[model samples]
Target: MENNFAENISPAFSSIYEEYETLSKENYCDIYRRNTIRKHVETYLNPKDTILEINAGSGIDAVYFAKAGYNVLATDIADSAGIYIKNKIKTEGLKNLEFQKCSFTDLSSIENKKFNHIFSNYGGLNCTNNLEEIFSQFNDLLHPKGFVSLVIMPKFYPWEMATFLKGNKNAFRRWKKNGVLANVNNHLIPTFYHSPKQIKRAMGNDFKAVSIKNIGTFYPSLHYNSLHKHPKTINFLMHLDSWINGKSIIPKGIGDYFIITFQKNT
Candidate 1:
């Protein structure tokens, strides 16, 4: 059953990616939500390093990284991603960035190259049914002492738990299940959820955890647009969340996502 489910995963994600590209800037959930992660990248990455971004949705981050002087290679399995990202690169007149169509499972296509840094934002890797395989591939592509940063959806999130307790059982149920089939344009894709410890364990000796920070600790998911109606309130909450997020271990799980940074062993 798992094998069959995994085999059918691409179609569902393809549909989701297609719809995601069509969404207008105002309606795009990733832009505002990814602000925190983008800030982190700005802080850590240097100008000379070569960076590879997996699941480079719409090339937003790619453009940012390229402008910052990093040689950027952005890739995604989505059929529309290449065209969308290329157009973005052209529009921005960014010369340092290149876009490609590739799946996380198959890094062999680009294996001859090594990257100084590798990143995937917004739960892109979590969509895969097998994480260990992906990690193994990542290990191969990274240069010695390279950095790998990923923003992922942990199995437990406070908002989701609270929402579930308030009679929305389906929201809570997604975490309990080890694997879930996300519906995208009438297609089903297998998605795997992991805990922080599980992810660390999977990376094993190849990568060392440098930092693990919480994102959106108080700023709820973008799906809840009702919260955005109050700008002052949302801004206050976001500031408080950012302060507490870096300090507390437990509060990190309260957010919808977490950013985990790992450095490859030299």
Candidate 2:
């Protein structure tokens, strides 16, 4: 990652890093994101694999993976999140986890070992405009035949677009632009949404596209906070989402986020 990019964006992430855990607890959507990733990851993961988690905000997923027997090096741009993860590791006596303060594009800073899995959950990679350049780092950091699972926001989501009916055109149309300014903890954070095809192009031929599954397909986008009040409806949506995500009949790249997995070609 460029020094200027990190310098400009660090403050925006830092502003929200402290309250991140609290927000995660309050947000049912976040729980959905984590549950979706964990369920998908279990299908392919082995205990011997090592993981490099990018944008590991609060390291929730990292800790979960570590607990499941994979050693995880969780990296985040925010120093506060890194400190919090470190303290959690200490409190829990979790030796399989490591914390690093770094951006997703800056994995080169770590020099010791190559990882078998790289994970970026819930739109972490969407913060940058340089998908092609940033993805080039993956081949170097991961071992041959290694896998990467990315849960990313794409350029289009039907659920989000449904907001237009409610007179929130701005929210509905945010992804129409190449870049949009998001208010994160009162700070303006620039976010860019990428298509599944764009991510595949960025990864290039060295990596084979394994699968792409919809996450927010039948379920409404997380922005509809009011829907959380209906437990029965939310439960039904969760079951529906699970059933529809991996079905090829469902269109790809239309959900709030999609999970795309790839394996480095040996």
Candidate 3:
């Protein structure tokens, strides 16, 4: 991880970045989500392919993929990430993993880098509305027939609606047009929800859809983290989640988040 790579990082989201692992680290729902997302990516691309990962928070996924035999360049806007990422590299002795403090919108720092696979997880791209500007850069970075996998929130989620019924006021925040202000540790960060269609359209003719899979559909939200205490209930929910985890009859863009994969096309 480079020391001076991240520049102009906002003070608002900076604390959220530093406290991210603390927030989700104990959430079992998040643990399941990460493993499921990794399985989908592994199924889509080979370990031999190098990956350029944007918004690589805490570098957990980067380290996981690197240990699984993939070379990964993990980029994040959080300078605080350097400390955690560096510690992981030193302790894990990871040679295939590299870290850069880069934002997806401005790839100029890594513009010369080419990769067979690009990954951004957990709605990091939702922070900005300039996706067209972002996807245009993908044309230059991805090899022909290479893959891009993103995990993004949709306009609507059934489970979120269920949470709404239970009095979670922010449940329907995705409906906001200009985007919603995500209250992270009392700091407001703007977030936008995007559908799979919107993402593919922005990706343009240079990419073709490969798969759309449910992530956390039928699985209880981490907000319901207490459900983890009940083994029988957890087993039943996990079974339903497994049934809907991969490609299914369920339409796209209807999960807590969906992992959509696209391949670069000539």
Displacement of the residue 209 alpha carbon in candidate 3, Å: 0.7
lDDT of each: 0.75, 0.80, 0.78
Ranking by TM-score: 2, 3, 1
Error of 1 at 155 (Å): 1.3
Stretches of candidate 1 above 4 Å error? 1-32, 249-252
Top candidate, metric TM-score = 2
Error of 2 at 140 (Å): 1.7
Per-candidate clashes, comma-separated = 0, 0, 0
lDDT of 3 by residue, 173-217 (tens): 887887876665565666788988899899898889988887777
Off by over 4 Å in 3: 1-27, 245-247
Residues 104-174, candidate 1: write the lDDT tens digits. 77777885678988999878877765678888888778888889998888877666677766688567654
Clashes by residue pair, model 2: none
Candidate 2 lDDT over residue span 107-198, tens digit each: 89978879999899888888787887778888988988899999888877777777778887675554666577667766666677888888
Highest lDDT: which candidate?
Answer: 2
